[model samples]
Target chain A: MRHLTDDEIQGYLDNHPDSDREKIRAHLDICGQCRSNLENYQIIAGQLNTDHIPALSPGFTDAVLSAIKPDTQDVPVEEPSRLIAWMSAAAVFILGIASTIYFTGSSVAKNIIALFSPANITEPSFVSRYKEYISGIDLDLTLVFAVALVLAVIALIDRMIKRRHKPVSFMI
Target chain B: MDDKTSIVRKIVAGDKRAFRLLVDEYQRLVNHIAFRMVSNPGDREDICQDIFMRVYQNLAGFRHDSRLSTWIARIAYNCCIDYLNKNNIPFIDEEFDETISNMPGGSITPEQQLYKSDISNLLQKEIGLLPVKFRAIITLYHLDEMSYAEIGDIMSMPEGTVKNYLFRARRLLRDRLMLKYGEEELRQ
Candidate 1:
């Protein structure tokens, strides 16, 4: 007689199929090796079933609870709308760029016009004004760059502070 | 509403007390999965925390289709898999013969044999040594008392595959036991 396959033996152990189970039972009764194998499988199954689950460490619930930040009230806090924030930021950036261009372009245009004016090109007074205009443009550019650098530094510091203050959910 | 639904609703409604209650209720279930999947005792707590945080963050999106426990379990299982993949831990599926040959061998003293707990402890250690998949299936099936279908849902595998894994895992454990303690000791 052919021996039962592992699947068949497992099915028999699980009581999966009625007919197949009966066939295995008959075979086990007649065959010592299969019977022993079946017993071995049964013991292992029993042990697997009986294995104990270790309990969570003491204060486990408290640890989890402590990690979570509790809402102050039942009502959810209304966060400032992100769309409004983005639109405001975009408006500020556009305004800054537009104002810089308008001021610099107007100054440059005035200097260029003054230089090309037939009478004013050689005038000492016009030359002084043109030099002043050039210096003013340089100063304006320097101020804009300084303001941008300061804003970037402030934003970076603000981000670092927020991250440092953010409550960590896990202990580690 | 069912208890689960009521609890979930309270949690989603910014009820910290309700969330605490939910955590208390499911801590063991999460711990069981995390502990079995992660061998390192130090990492288990962090993994459990991460799983619950994910659950809490996504609580608002939870539809009532599946049981809350199953949903949490799925999150836990995914977290475990992520931990394994992230750490580059090799979850090799060793063949039965290979596992048996590598099984730790030493005769149990007569005194040790007298205590059944030692045998059970050895069995558990061997279970822990099984591949990640096998450890997961064994824990979910036997310790958590989850059905094969639930395990399949959590692990994202077909039910048949779950059953096959379960069987193979158990057989590997059995073979390990036979090798470690001899067939005579196991038969008793």
Candidate 2:
């Protein structure tokens, strides 16, 4: 009869389901070499099966807790309601500005053109009139509103992208 | 809600105490993976901290698809792999036989092998000489008491591969032990 392979011996000692224990036992009755191999593997497996976790540094939990304290900036996921609220705010702001421009007939583009015109610059009253123009013109408010809208849109897109690709450290 | 979901919710809600509880719960599992994969003594603690930080950072993304411990263990394993790569250590040593064959002989006597403590110490030493992947498989299997399926999930390998590597690692450890102190001595 052929001797048991090392895999067979180790598997038998490990109590592996695939190992035929009765047949191996019958074989062991006739084979001393395979039994010896099984005994050696048994010793090693016994040592390994015991819990032998290496010691971590004292206060490991404390250290990790403290390390994560300042670093745990939880970026809340944007809910649909919240996204809608932002969009609504942007829409209302734009609509309000458009309505003001439409109803008041304040032509911001025409004022800008008038301010930069050479004819307006060459006049002696240009500085005071320009100061008055700068103070009274709605272009500043419109410009401010437009800048704020651009910023808000950029921030919203950035948050969406971040949410979509939030650094998945390890996906199972 | 389940304990895991509750803790995860509390953690995601900026509850530091809940996060602390999580750290306390899974620190051993994380430390085991880190200690097995990372050889440097100093980097071990740092790597553990890094793993937890990543866990905290990404907890919101966890969808309860697996056990929390298994998920944290996966992070720890990946962090150690990153450390090994950054430090230019080959994660899988190609010439692993040289590692075993080159082990100094007769350094451990049969008398030393008689003591369980001595045998465990020698076993740890021999395990350290294994390739990185094998060492991790051994650690997760024996120390962590994880199933082959769970280990396969963490290491991103099939269950069969984990079992095979585990068998090979044990066989290698046995060979090394028998080489240092002969088979009859180990039977004692």
Candidate 3:
């Protein structure tokens, strides 16, 4: 008795493979067990193909609607951390100023210390020679402030220039 | 309330009453989908509630570009997928054959088959066990009777992708039935 290979069976099931149909039929004719199993499988397939979508039970929708419609009494208070953001920003600005002062002070103090020991310097160490070349760390406070003031004035002037186009109401 | 635009108008006017009407009408459709996508009844209810709650919260952002039903359906679709992902369910890929070959077809009587089924019930179970997207896509297409274009719009899938999913979902079902039951059972 000839038997069908798994591939041949799958080909028939999928119905596309190049397996010769007569060969499969002949094998099926000879093989009782494959035929039986195939029959069982086909029956099960038919049973499953029935499209019976279940109906929604009574009040199912109402129950779901109830779950959705809760009493709106509990309000989640919005944690407005705007003040916290402002406070943190203010803290950083203060810290930035403090760090600038401390850094400048330390740089100047180091230069002063390096200069005081100049007698012991023949080929001045990089630190002392750097200080000798420039007593300060070359911080031009006036120029720096002047540029900052100019930027502020330019920004203010630009804002005023833009403001003139505003549709202002001549309310008495 | 069933008129989609009217519901939106009423809902926008701070009408809690309007919301209840929308929730009442659409909750079945939402729950039907949610229940099919996720097997747990409780989770289904939770997802349904969340969808309505979201409808309330994001009402302001909704433009009148689309019908309210479609918009709400899109939201419910998203909410179900989100719920599935958050719960660690895997998305189904159209990668493998799911048909079982050894189903008992001839041995069982047609009467037995009919008596044994609530096909939709078994269908929900099988569909739920599929890759999550398969279940959602199938439910959206079949139970909701949504057009491919509407399904695509709701899912944000390309129309082609939605069509492929619709085909894959049916193929998966056929394959699953083939594996569990045989070809004759299908034809019968």
Candidate 4:
């Protein structure tokens, strides 16, 4: 006959308080480790069987319930985190820069026209060249408006695309 | 109304006084379970109160299919387990020392009931150090004198599993106690 495994002996050891039970009896005869383990389990179980439950503190239950229960009238309001505040600030800055470029573009075009007026005709001098160079700022400002418009359009399109697709957090 | 159903009705009717009625009855039971699971009075108190307050808030959602005690016991057990995992607090709550100190050997109680035999003391310490579930299984099955069926109800586990836990908990208890026995226990 095949001998009982350690698990069966362990199982028997756990369920049977009497160490002298037949299955445990047979197993212990042959296996020293099983015998030792069984004996140890008994000693432990015996000790545990006598344990006392802890006493309740004075008004302990009431104290605990009171401590954790939120006030009925005034639930605490939650504040948004720092990251959200930073994102809002960045959005405001970007909008300000774009608005500045848009408003300045027309004024820049008017100044470029004024700078080219014919009354001041010292055409061959370095100062005229320097003035022309200086006059380019208006065109450059218009160019900034153009670039800003393109960037705003691209950003809008990007936002629209992202919104349409709407990266949803799906959990399976 | 059936007991749990009546309690539910009272809590739902917004009878704040009825809330205390529920607490008075279930507090010891929940505290006992939490105390066993966490092994600390303070942490056990925290867990016990958490379970009840959760019950209070979620009372409207309570279905009367299962016993209220069982439902709340599950809550108590789960909260203790969560606290252990979240804080890595080693299942034995800080208040466990207070409970341990109050145990038969551990407590200074003059009551004969508090007087722990040496072997019992060794076993208590080991159970105190075991995992929360192991501690709970022993407390419910042996300490509370609950049957496997009752334990199954409290834990929402099958009776077979409760038996398994009880046996394992007992064996573990035995092994730990034997360690302190030296050769004297063996020779005996």
Candidate 5:
């Protein structure tokens, strides 16, 4: 008969249910070489079976507990005053732009009016012409442009804030 | 109704004390995986903490498909692997011959190096020298006493693969010990 393989020997040592323990035992009883191999493997298994894991330092649990943020799942409520301030500022800017468009009759205002007018919907060529006209016109619309940029920045910041405070679901 | 379900519910309901208890329960298992897979001592603590934190974050997604310990171990294992990848550490699955032949007994105490007869210490050094995955398998199998199927779930491998790696790991460890100290000393 062929001698037992290492797997069989280990399976025997491990008392693995699938291993033919009686067969392996019979072999080991007669086979000195396989028996020696079993003995050596047993020693290795003995060393591995020992609890060699080092203990983590004291207060590991407390440190982790302390690090956990409280109410992590709760969404932070946005301040109503901040929201009001943003809305008021936006309203003031829109009012300023409306006043400028009404009083100045600026060519920029004409293009802006044309860009939104219902009459321009049917005239496809008016879209490209409007773009060309707006690009060519040198209006002193720095205030308007600056206000629009600020509003955009404010909207982006609001989105970021909302995202940061979004409530996490407790269950999937 | 069961203890695990109740504990998980308490934790999901934002119970800090329950979370603390959960951390206490699994810290040893987490530490074993972290220490076995990650070599850097300095990063081990942080990695362990991160593992627990991740467990907390993802606990809501736990679907009662596996044991809580097994789920936590899977988190710990993945966290260590991610740390290894992020740090550009070589977690290769290469054969152990070159590595074992090349690896010196890992950073040992001067006294340990001097005596060199402590079999447990030698075994630990050899374990450290194994490929990361093998070290993890050894820890999960022998230290944690986890079932092969549970280890398979934790490591995202088949049970057969886990068994093969475990057998190969033991064989390599045995062969190395035998070669170094001979059968007589090991038999003792």
Candidate 6:
């Protein structure tokens, strides 16, 4: 029989059935050189099996622990409630309008008062002045733009907060 | 829960003590893989620390499909590969080329070199001189006692490839041992 190849010997050593281990075994019984080769392979395998695993240096665990930031570092930032933010913006807008009316005098104030009073809404002078103010300012579009700006600011703040909570490695 | 699951859960729950336990438990495995892949002794500790730090960061994503050690080893293997790539080191696996110089023998005096002539130290030194892929296969198979399948997962190779690499690595190591120390010296 031909000598067992190194691969076959390795397979036999590893207990792989692909090697026809029994055939190699039988051959080894009759062949001195093949037996010696097998012995050599076994010795090498033995050394590898017994290879030393180097120990970690003292305080290695502590060193690793210290290197890792605390889990709290990754905690998601607490976002301000969106509803509360919107309500605060609305309150500020209303207060600004009320202060403007208070400072601008009774003519504009009466017009503003007339706009809120359903009974006086159809009075011709008050209605003409209110219509003039509405036509001049385009209040509907202004409200839409103001609402959009507030939403954009809220989204920007949300994104910044989320970005800050991203893992530190990502920043690096 | 099994010990691994318990440890993983605790770690995920933000337990620093459990994270410490994890580092204590797997430091040797990580260090072994790192030492085998990275020939520079100075880089091994940093690599190990980086591996565990990554594990901590990604702990929440680890599914229990494989052993926890296997997962950690996979991370270690990938980190070493990245390090090699970043440093532009070529990974040679097929034949042992003696022309390529081994890593510098940092801080080893002549006396230390003489004392390191023991078979084990010589064997380890030779293993370190091997290409990173061969060193990793030998480390996973022999030192870590990992199965070929697990090694395949860790190294991202097929099981057949894992077996082939294991056989080739051992044969190369044996040949190196025979050439340097002779058959008689190996018989010991």
Using DockQ as the measure, the top candidate is 6
Cα lDDT for residue A14, model 6? 84
Per-residue lDDT over A23-141 for candidate 4, one digit per residue giving the tens place of the 0 to 100 score:
56776788777666666655554545564666666686567446543443133233444554454555556556656656786577566657885566656688678877886864454
User: Chain B alone: TM-score in each candidate?
Assistant: 0.88, 0.89, 0.79, 0.72, 0.91, 0.86
Question: How would you encode candidate 5's per-residue C-alpha lDDT over B80-181 as one tens digit per residue?
Answer: 989999999988776556444565653445765554578888889788878898899988888889988999999999988888888888888887777677
TM-score-superior candidate, 1 or 2 = 2
**Candidate 3 RMSD to the real structure:** 17.4
- Give residue B9's lDDT in candidate 4 (0 to 100): 85
Clashes of each: 0, 0, 22, 12, 0, 0
**Comparison by TM-score, 3 against 5, better one:** 5
Candidate 2 Cα misplacement greater than 4 A, ranges:
A69-172, B98-100, B103-117
Whole-model Cα lDDT of every candidate shown, in order: 0.75, 0.79, 0.60, 0.61, 0.82, 0.77
Report model 6's chain A TM-score: 0.56
Model 6: colliding residue pairs? none
Candidate 3 regions with alpha-carbon error over 4 angstroms: A1-172, B92-122
Error of 2 at A6 (Å): 1.6
Q: Which docking category, incorrect, acceptable, medium or high, applies to candidate 2?
A: acceptable
Instruction: Give me the runs in candidate 4 sitting further than 4 Å from their true place.
Output: A1-51, A64-172, B39-41, B89-117, B147-159, B182-188
What is the lDDT for B20 in model 6?
Answer: 85
Enumerate the candidates' DockQ scores in order. Answer: 0.27, 0.28, 0.05, 0.15, 0.28, 0.35
Work out the TM-score per prediction.
0.66, 0.68, 0.50, 0.50, 0.70, 0.72
Quick one: RMSD of model 5?
A: 10.8
Query: Given the true complex, what DockQ would model 5 score?
Result: 0.28
Candidate 2 local lDDT, residue A66:
66
